[model samples]
Every structure is written in C-alpha cells, then in structure tokens.
Target: MYKILIVEDDNTIAEEVGRYLMKWGYEVEAVTDFGDVLGHFGRFLPQLVLMDIGLPFYNGYYWCGEIRKVSQVPVIFVSSASDNMNIVMAVNMGGDDFITKPFDLEVMAAKVQAILRRTYSFSAPTSLMEYKGMILNLSDMTLVCRDEKIELSKNEYRILQTLFENTGKTVTREAIMKRLWDEECFVDDNTLTVNINRLRKKLEGLGVEELIVTKKGIGYRLGEL
Candidate 1:
C-alpha cells in the first residue's frame, strides 16, 4: 500500500482524512508537532503528503518548502484558503495539487490516486533521507547541506545512512557494522571508527557540530541543535 503523510493540524480533519485513506488501504500518519514538520516527514517517509496551509507554528508553505529541499515526494495542499493567490502560492512552493477545505472525500482520494500513479509510474522513487536540515541523496551518493556537498565512500555512506534512518533513537554500533559487514569483509573496529570520523568531518563542514553523537558505550545518534 502507498504511504500517505498528513500534515494537517486540525484533529478532526486530520483523523477524518486518516480514516478515509485507511479505508482505501493507504497507510497514513498525521502530524502532531507543528514546530518540526520536516522531522516527521523524515521519519514517516511517506509516498504522498496532504498538507494544510494555515497551521500552528509555521504555515503549510514553510513546511512545503522544507520538504521540497529534500525529496521530490508528491505534496497535495489541502486548506481552507483555496483562493487563487493561495493556490498559486502552493504551486510556487512545490505543491503537486490543491484541494480546498470541506472537500468531497471521494474526489480527494481520486486526485491522490492519480497523482501517485503519475509520479511513481515511470521512475522508482528516490530513496534519499533527510533529518533536521541535512539531505542524504541515495541516488547520487552525496550528502548536501544548505550550500555545500559531501561525497561519501561506500562504507561511510552506509554507516551514515543507517544512523540517519534511525535518528531520534540510539543505533547500536553492532547494528551499523552488521549492515556494513553485509557488503564488505570482516571489518575491524579501527575501520569502523575511521569511517565514522570521515563521515563526521563531512558533516562538520556542513556546520553541524557533533552531528553524530557517541552515546557512551552504547551506540550513535543524530541530535537536533
């Protein structure tokens, strides 16, 4: 089933959309934190997004811009401000389609189905992930900061990729090496440390201080500043 991430703030409408989408067999997750929209977007990794313009902290346009910075996932704007200006702004901010508030559920579903098919039919979806403000592009094997870029070696990319995917939680070193060990021969502790240090320096260049935190004797984690 296709995943649908709902960035609607209103509980009634968000849950309503969730219910409707669930009935149609699309997995759904509603946004609970207004201040950290991109965080949820990274964690959810939804195939499609339904966002409302007027929100609690930053508006939908702000969140839309943030999502656009990382992935090309289809985002359909759903808002009461369906004026010509808002519609045009949504498009300018990278929204795929617009649906005014108090919409027919069936029509919304139809638009969603059409957009997903059109967007993902001919090409495989990009698998790069983002957290906070960093983007790890799996297609090109590069990590991009606001303006700078970091090229990753195979081991460095896998290690960073695994940690990013499990950000907001502790990822054991063993887990990281198990993933690395799958692709390469017996990796020594020094080898893993070298890879992690290289990845950290690349991230440091991006202005992220201590991007990957060592959790004592446990594992590694990405923390928001």
Candidate 2:
C-alpha cells in the first residue's frame, strides 16, 4: 500500500483526510507536531505528502523543500489559500500538485492515485532508515540531520546501518566484523576502530554527539545524545 503523510495542523481536516485515505486502502498518517515536520517526514518515509499552506511553526512550503533535500516523493499542497501566488510558491518549492481546501474526497483520492502511478511506475521507492532526527537514505548512502546532508563512506554506512537496525541494543564486534566480512570487505580490529572513530567525528559534526556508545568488552550501540 502506498503511504501518505498529511501535514495539516487542523485536527478536523487532517482526520477527515486520513480516514478517507485509509478507507481507500492507502496508509495515512497526520502530522501533529508541526515544529518537527521534517523529523516526522523522515520517520514516516511516506511515498507522498499532503501538506497545508498555513501551518503552526513553518509553512508547508518549508517542509516541502526539506523533503526535497532527502527525497523525491510526490507532495501535493492542500490549502485554503489557493491564490495564484501561493500556488506558484508551492510549485517553486517542489510541490507536485495543489488541492484547494473543501476538496471532494474522491477528487483528492484520484489526484493522489494519479501522482502515485506516475511517480512509482517509473521508479522504485527509495529505502530510508530514520532514528531520532537523522534520516539515512539507503539508496544514496547518505545521512540527513538538522538540514545537513552527510555523505557516508562504505564502511561508515555499514556501521551506521548495523547500529540503526538494532537500535537500543548492543551489537558485538564479532557480529559487526562478520557483517562486513559477508560484504567481502574484511577488516581487522584496528580498521574497525578507525572507522568507528571517523564515523563518530562525522556524526558529531552534524551535532549528533556520542550517538555510538562503546561497551568495553562487547561492542557498540546507539546512545541518546
């Protein structure tokens, strides 16, 4: 099923849209915390976003731009402000379509299905892993945190991917080494240490400090910053 993220702050409208989408066999989530729109977007990894123009903290345009940074997912603006200026701004900010408020559920669903067919028919959905506010784009091997995009090396990407897959749990060095070995990139203890240190530095640079915690005898685990 295609997933949709609704970024509308109005509870009644959001609920109505969510219910309508769910009834049509589409997975839907309505955003509640407007301050962390991108954070929710990262975590949800929805195939398409339904955004409203007048939001609580940042407007829909800002969130749409942020989504464009890490994803090419289709975004349709749903707002009462259907003026030409707002519509132009929405498209300029990377919106795929705009739906005026008080819209018919059937019309909205049809537009959504059309966009999904056009977007996915030509490309597979990108895989994303998100923890905290950091989003890892598996297709591109890059991480986005606090609006900062960080490119990851092969080893760094593997280490982070392993940790994320087993969040809140310790992963033994032997297990990590085995995973790397399975990928045909054998690394000694020293090399692993270097990679860990480098990854830590990169994470710190993105304001994520002490995320990878080292458990002396066992291995490393993701820690709260």
Candidate 3:
C-alpha cells in the first residue's frame, strides 16, 4: 500500500480525510506539528502528500519546498485557497495538483488515484530515489544533487541504478553483470568494475563521494548520504 502524508491543522478534517483514505486502502498520517512539518514528512516518507494552505508555523508551500529538496514524491494541495493566484503558486511551489477544499471525497479520491497511476502504474521510476540531498530521477535516469544536474552514460547510470535500487542490501557482482548483459550490453566481469569506477568519479564530483561502495567479495551498494 502507498503511504500518504496529510498536512492539515484542522483536527476534524484530518480525521475525516484519514478515515476515507484508510478505507480506500491507503496508509495515511496527518501532520500534528506545524512547526516541524518537514520532520514528520521525513519520517512518514509518503508516496502522496495532501497539504493545506493556511497552516500553523510555516505554510503548506514551505513544507512542500522542503520535501522537494529531497524527494519528488507526488504532492497535491487540498486547501480552501481556491483562488487562481493560490493555485498558480501551488504549481510553482512543486505541487503536482491542487484540490480546493469543501471537496467531494469521491472526487478527491478519484484525483488521488489518477495521480498515483500516472506516477507509478506505468514504466516510471516507481518513484524517485533519494539519498542525503540528492534525488535520482529514475524516469529520466538523471541524478540531481542540489541545483546541479549530472547526466550519466548508459553503463554508469545502469550501475548506479542497480546499487541504489538495492540501497541497504548489497547487490552481487554476478547479478549486476547479468542485468547489464540482459540489456544487450556485453560484460566480462571486469567491465562492471570499469563502469563502477567511472560512476564513482562522477558522484564524487557531485559531492556524493564514494556513493557506491564495493563489498570486496559481494558487490556494491549505495549506503550513506
């Protein structure tokens, strides 16, 4: 099930939205501390976020930008601020969609489903891969470190993709070779090594030094920030 983060101050609305979302088979958590919206966000790490405009400490747009700094998870604004200016600002602030408040729960659910499908039901990245401050765009196969964009060569990207996909656990070299070879790329074991070295250099240049580490006998992994 996809996790969802709800950033609304109204306790009634939070319970109401959380209830329906749970009924629809989504794991949801509503924000409790407006001052620490980003903190709760990192802990929840929801696939979709429902944010309200007028909030306690920092507004929804502030929290949205904070989340965007590390992730590209789909965020939809749900607020009473239905004015065109607010909607435009929402989009500019990295909100994927805007749902004006006093909305039909059914319609809200429909839009949520559509956005989830567009982001995950297809051959997308499944979702963006995030490490410390970098977001790896699996859709376009690009690594984003801060404001810098680093493009990867075919082999380099594939190698990094494999390691990050299996971030915590180590991916064996044999498996890496098989995957690369399966892509119609020839590899004689040492080929993977060459690609990894090059990818590491690129990552180090982007401040993600030693982003991919070898396990001597096992393979490689993207362990830390």
- TM-score per model over all chains: 0.76, 0.95, 0.67
lDDT of the candidates, in the order given = 0.86, 0.91, 0.81
Better of 2 and 3 by lDDT: 2
Residues 62-146 of candidate 1: C-alpha lDDT, one tens digit per residue: 8898877667899999998878999999999999999988999999999999999999999877786877757787876777666
**Tens digits of lDDT, candidate 2, 1-225:** 999999998899999989999999999998899999999988888999999989998888888888888899999999999999999999999999999988999999999999999999978998888899888888889999998899999889989899999999999998888776676666678888988999999988988898999999999999987
lDDT of 3 by residue, 122-207 (tens): 64423566665566656667776745677778777677778767868899998888777776656588778888888888878877
* Model 2: lDDT of residue 51: 93
lDDT-superior candidate, 1 or 3: 1
Best TM-score goes to which candidate?
2
In model 3, the runs with Cα more than 4 Å from the true position are 1-3, 9-12, 30-47, 54-59, 62-74, 92-97, 100-127, 130-134, 147-149, 182-190
Model 2 pairs whose backbones collide: none
Clashes of 1: 0
For model 3 the local lDDT of residue 100 reads 87
- Give the per-residue Cα lDDT of candidate 2 at 144: 92
